[model samples]
Target: MTTDAPVSAEQQRREEELVERVLRSFDGCADPRLATVMRSLTRHLHAFLREVRLTEQEWEAAIAFLTAAGHITDDRRQEFILLSDVLGASMQTIAINNEAVGSATEATVFGPFFVEDSPEISIGGDIANGATGQPCWVEGTVTDTTGRPVPGARIEVWEADDDGFYDVQYDDGRTAARAHLFSDAEGRYALWGITPTPYPIPADGPVGGLLEAVGRSPLRAAHLHFMVTAPRCRRLVTHIFVRGDDLLDRDSVFGVKESLVKDFVTQPAGTPTPDGRVVDGSWSRARFDIVLATEEEQR
Candidate 1:
């Protein structure tokens, strides 16, 4: 192991001048927001480099890592989002954009697994769609903060199967364990899904290597994804974590909120499901009442 040489006063001054030059380069940006973001990013990036006394070798290594991340990203996977999630950047952005509004459900990181045009299911329909896992019954209601029901809200739900694999990972063009459904006239929604199990974020790529180098676990807690939208309300993208999941305190994405943890009551064999559906063995049930902030309230 080699030690870094002490930084000289002249070297520090030159570094500062270089940072200012980079920031000034963005002054001509037509977009005010873009200009501001670039200036701040330059300042912080330079500061970090100075604080760490980053070496040329380290910089080269960082570039190589980013190149690997880019190489692996495709329509089915997003390595950059995984990088953001593990670094807490995604959660921070979510917190900034999703300020609490009088008991409105809190937002969390929108994991990269989400897809468009998920098959639509009706109330009490099974989203599992042949995905392998124990059956789960999910019931919920959507309402505005004032306690009034918001009928016709669209709810999109998805989760990994028991083996910690989403349908998208299979490459078979199959759509399972994900679906969209509309809330009924009473603003109530119910569906059948598999019990969510703890799973690691994709670990076969550069993000996984970074986590390993930093001694971090890639495991996310058991939870179900939900994106709800209704007329004149702020869209809510969130998750309901299983109450007793051990990983709740250390979700890899840092997405858990205490209010979003809910009990998933277990039912042994012979217990009757709410909709008179039959299960071969044990199953579970969970209820999540979601409240959304109106657009005006969100503002």
Candidate 2:
């Protein structure tokens, strides 16, 4: 019978020595968690380099690409997040931390466009704030896993305009197409906004070049981002995608989840809304109930 030859002592020693040297470099890390993370990262990174037989030119090119990505990042744009999203690292990290539990809404990527201190509006108030699109009504309840109401929960929402651009994309630094609303005493919430439409993630930077090189499309499925938080409950960062958006099957960032898809029922002009809001033309409505995991469940 044929058998493989054993690794020579000299070669095995050299391989071990390389890894050991890297680990030893982090031996003085004061934080236990940081040390563990750095050690693990070193092992995998070295393994990847060895397995690919990476050349010096390739390493230099990778460094240059990362540097370019950083150069394009600014207050309004986040190229590193775009890179992580395209590489599936963002989604993988979310999956590791957000396991399903008790029918709570499944979490998804918090895209790079989110901004703090969005203007607050009451239920049935409009959040369009000048940006144009087909008006949409979003209504929902914030409830605990056991069907109990989570009164006074905060719900922050944001979405791209019909032109496939977020508020931050504008040069004037104005806010539009986003709002912050709170649930009432009965855990009910509603607000008016624009219907979501399929859009491409920003593609003018190094990450975009990488996507083009790999023959991948940069389109993200139509969806509205929601961040719901309540007392003593886990905060949920998720998106409610349009049920029939063509891009749903192949979201560029792989953020689409079956549980998060919902129907956006279209209504013709003059349709009356529950909150007595007037509609001048065709509009859409989406009902998305958020189930928040309790503190205990999160543990």
Candidate 3:
């Protein structure tokens, strides 16, 4: 090896030593707060690189891939989140933090496709249009564990088009299949939408490249996304997955939880949805009740 190269053995040693020195900087941290977390993260991350014998070329490629993921973020999209989803990090975090949630309501990864301030729709409204799936009506009651009603509960919902693309992804305005509804006096909430079909997550960018490199497929099971928050209810961001979606076990994000999976029922066509959209025979129905942990419990 030539000594004149940009980096030599001595240079590599010096660089790794510098990393070690930087990692120890947080030692004896009286706060034991952020510093503790930061130092542990540093140790594990450095160990991972060493354990994998990560190469310079691979590191550079990883940096470039992350840069590209950041480049795709916009007002309506977050590529970093998409990357995290494909990496299974997001789902893991959700699972770790929500371990105590009972059979009341299951939480899942909130994808990069959510649109806040969803258009308001009435109970029994039809959220799906131009769908080529089953026919059914979604009905459920939002309540606490004691089965007490939760009135005026706000439920924000969204789902992919029949083609597996969200309205925002297609650059469509806040339209059908994405709306917010509130629980009625009975703490009952219902909506009508098409049966969901397994769809691929974004696979045209750096995230896609990484997935391909890792031999992982970029597919999410058919499901409906919901974020429910009320004054007294512990907020929940979850999905109702299709019972038999082909991708259930292989959800690219690892976002599928057994409790979150729901049975998709089919009803007759031309059934008048509470929203006044006549079901065209191809629709699906799901029922999920949300339970709230006390505010103090969440804390």
Candidate 4:
């Protein structure tokens, strides 16, 4: 037989007291929502430490790794984003925020290479700008989920060259392989660009070290990035992966979606382009139709 005894609040352990102190620190936060988030973050972080029974050496190593990531980051390179991508944080956030909705194009990561103020091009113009690769004709239409055409829509497109490097990666500082175009009265748009090619993320940095440590490849599948916008539709950022890409099953950033893959039909040399442009060698063509979610749907 055992006698029952009541425990007092004074019996709280040191770990429990520390957690309570951190939570109490959030009490003075001016914003209620921020306070709520801080409270949750404090609880989760402390719990993680407890669960892992993390040692001081491990904590210091983590701090050093993050510091190195920050040191390598700059205006053109985003080491933090690469870190988040490799850690699956970026993709997880994207998944939580962009659940699939009826026929609206699926969203993906706005990758590290994106830059503001890309040059605009007319329909049928070439965005490759002499980048080395086989010519590819990309034609598509912008429409709403209801199947109505979205005239005057703006579409920004960018891709890596055959060598798997973006325009910004070169020391020359000249832009190529990217352009912005407007939809026609019938919502049709077309432009010429280089065929998409697989490329590894910058491997000379801390993110690369982390990938190597974990035995993860830094290669992303071949794809074309697009940012489409219309007056009443939500802005869509996405990618169209090349069909039959070997890396589709293992995109380093976890950015691929089945609906976004499309066929890039090969055309032999001497075939007339849709816009009657002269081509001396083999070329390719792909057609992708974009559907936008309405403002209400976005809300």
Candidate 5:
């Protein structure tokens, strides 16, 4: 019998053969791209397990957790994104395909909050849907490197209310703190919404169990999500984090970028402001600029 050192030469050959067998099943597959991806994933996954000497019980536990993750996924939410986020895989994938922007704003994770077919709104329209929460006004401009306005750019923004919960989580049968807006004749916009609050990613499923096992906290700092796109410009899908937030550095998904952080300045009462902007008492403002890349889309 071979000692439990690493693996016998025969065992190594068997492992390689097992990987080959799995790849061979993809023969005559319609989607060649998917086949290639499956092959790569299988090869790397098998090799990693072997290299790490994953125990049988650990492998079973992983499988059980994955089964639970799939069971939790349904029509309303995506538990897989939550799993990937907690494992930092989602951010790593985004980083690999992240756009390069010297003068433009960079792209980040398109978290699982956005839904399909949001109502189109005007530049200064309030997206809070009149939900009860603190008043926050976010304003920004969409322009290129030459300071030219990128008119007609669509800006999609969403975030959780002050209670640190998305409307989808509340079963309210409505979309809260979400809106899709197109820039007017100019590249300016002022969005009004509820003040954001730090929220824990879906932690009731297998993902939460994984976090517990790793001794990691799953708190994501408060931030507003935005997805901006324009013809001939790089599409941005990211978040603008509140500067000085306590959980900024400890984002469970590792999605915080220093460039994306901005100060939420408090405007004193009765200050001169734009129409439909700040009114009587104290208000807050966040100014952000999204830079679009000419060479958009990952190849």
Candidate 6:
């Protein structure tokens, strides 16, 4: 490896001048917050370049990588989101915006697979509308931080199948393994899904190449997604991970939290399900009681 020479005093002075000029260009921004963000972003970006002593070839390579990512993105696949997730940017942003408030459930990254207007299922209904996996029984209660039940809260849930592929990843135009349901009068809800299994983020794109180059794995922990909302409560987008999942500590998206890990108790075949449903094989069950902060508390 060739050694990089230390930046000389004159070169450092010139670099600082360039950064100041770039910052000054944003002075006329009418939005005060926007101006501040732009200035700070410019400073950090310039500092990073200076620290790395980035070469022209490396900058060109970065541009090409971004171009490839853009080319591979589509309505079904989001390369940029995968890139952000692998880089820990998505989790970092979530942490910054979702400070812990009382005992409200912690928030995590919103993976790119979420789709709007998912079919709604009734309480105790099955969400696995044909996707393959071991059956899972999910039950939970929605409550405010004060322990009052929050009935009628909408809970949207989704996850990859046992094969580690979301329905959207297929070209069949079918929806499965995802649905939304509302809490009952008692703020309780239950549904049937599949046990989550560890899966790698899409590994055929620029982001995947970057991870490999940096000696990183793209595997996310086994988990199920949830987005809960109510009239007077802060919206929650989070996941409950399998407690014993081997990949929990090394989730590709860095979305795991101690509070979000839960046990998926295994039930042998012939065991009666909560709703009197029958299963031909073993299944799992989990409970995730959620508490939401009020809108005012979120502020």
Best by TM-score: 6
Number of the candidate with higher lDDT, 2 or 6:
6
- Deviating ranges (above 4 Å) for candidate 4: 1-12
Clashing residue pairs, candidate 1? none
lDDT of 4 by residue, 75-152 (tens): 989999998887788888877777777899999988998878999999998999878898999998999989899999
lDDT for 56 (candidate 5): 81
Q: What are the Cα lDDT values of the candidates? A: 0.94, 0.91, 0.77, 0.90, 0.80, 0.94
Report residue 153 deviation for candidate 5 (angstroms).
Answer: 0.9
The parts of candidate 2 lying over 4 Å away from their true place are 1-13
Tens digits of per-residue lDDT for model 2, 1-299: 11244557896689779999999999999999999999999999988776666678889999999999989998878899999999999999999988888789999999998999999999888889998899999998999999999999999999999999999988898899999999999999999999999999989889988999999999999999999988899989999999988899899999999999999999988888777777788999999999999888974
Q: Give the RMSD in angstroms, all C-alphas superposed, for model 5.
A: 2.8
Choose 2 or 5, whichever is better by lDDT. Answer: 2
Q: How many backbone clashes does candidate 3 have?
A: 5
lDDT head-to-head 3 vs 4, winner: 4
Q: What are the models' TM-scores?
A: 0.97, 0.94, 0.86, 0.93, 0.88, 0.98
Model 1 alpha-carbon drift over 4 Å, by segment = 1-6
| Cα lDDT tens digits for candidate 1, 97-184 | 9999998999998999999999999999999999999999999899999999989999999999999999999978889999999999
If ranked by lDDT, best first, what sequence of candidates would result? 6, 1, 2, 4, 5, 3
RMSD of 6: 1.1
Q: Which residue pairs clash within candidate 3?
A: 127-177, 134-282, 134-283, 135-267, 135-283
lDDT of 3 by residue, 189-246 (tens): 9886666778898888888888898899988888888888878667888998878778
Task: Sort the candidates on TM-score, descending order.
Answer: 6, 1, 2, 4, 5, 3
Clashes of each: 0, 0, 5, 0, 2, 0
Model 4 residue 122 distance off true place after TM-score fit, in angstroms: 0.8
- Report model 1's TM-score to 2 decimal places: 0.97
